[model samples]
Target: MNESTELGEDFKCKLPNVSMSTQSKTMPMIDLKVYIRVVAAVFSISSATALVMALLRLLTPNLFYVEPLDGSNIVLHYFITGLMVVTSAIGLLNSCVVMNRSAAKNTGRNITTWLLLDSLFETTRVVYVFICEVVIKGRGSLQTYEMLISIAQYLLDSFLYCQMILRH
Candidate 1:
């Protein structure tokens, strides 16, 4: 019996990092949930800020465009900015869902879905802004700074989501 006790101790000690036995008593369930929440929170806040910027551009049309060159651009801007507002609001709600510890277990799928949707929005918005920056404003428009920021944010978020997806 003494030898058996020693063997059991050795087994526990040799267990891998994710051993439920090891982490269960220590942290319970804060590990994955907290990290996921943090990521989602960042995504939410950034999306909100994007929403604001889009709204401002929509409100001040001439401020974004030097001249009223075409009707198609005005419509496209209106449509894309509206999408940004809706998607960002959903993204913010998703963050709140992940932040609540008692909400649900096995939320990996749901969170992944949200992240995928956010990724799509982020990528598409950056592309749309870039095309407008180059074609409409010669790449040095008033929205240039916002466009650059969006590009950087999208790249970072894409990398993080990719890593998280791979882990799960």
Candidate 2:
């Protein structure tokens, strides 16, 4: 019995020391700055694409046109397209600021504030478009694709902004 006890003690002594603190903890896969920069780049590309689509719809209606509900009133269609262009420009500008800050090594509350404002504006713009085209005018089918894309963008931007704020 003593020999067995001695053998058990020797076995215990040979084992590596491990504790709760020593164990690897789950950590973020990427650095916060890198994440911000990547997300900002994505936002920039999306904004640029939206801008191009809006411009195309505006300038070359024959090639890329999502016809408005009131076909007779071209003015409203132009106005909505103009709004999209302006909103996309704002989004692009905000993203550029975020991306530039990563290079400058400047992470400030002001940038996060700008991000919040941009997200709010983007959500508002999407909501307005939904109300105007789908609800009021009853023209949802014509621009379903654009509307869905815009809604998805809004959700993604909101989620990314929240994550950025939390990380910051």
Name the candidate that leads on lDDT: 1
lDDT of 1 at 121: 65
Residue-by-residue lDDT tens digits, candidate 2, 44-141: 87688677767766776544334533555466657777888888888888888878874455467666666775775576467546644554453434
What candidate 1 gets wrong by more than 4 Å, as runs, is 1-30, 101-103, 138-141
lDDT of 1 by residue, 31-77 (tens): 66566777777777777777777777767766667677477766777
Cα-based lDDT for every prediction: 0.69, 0.68
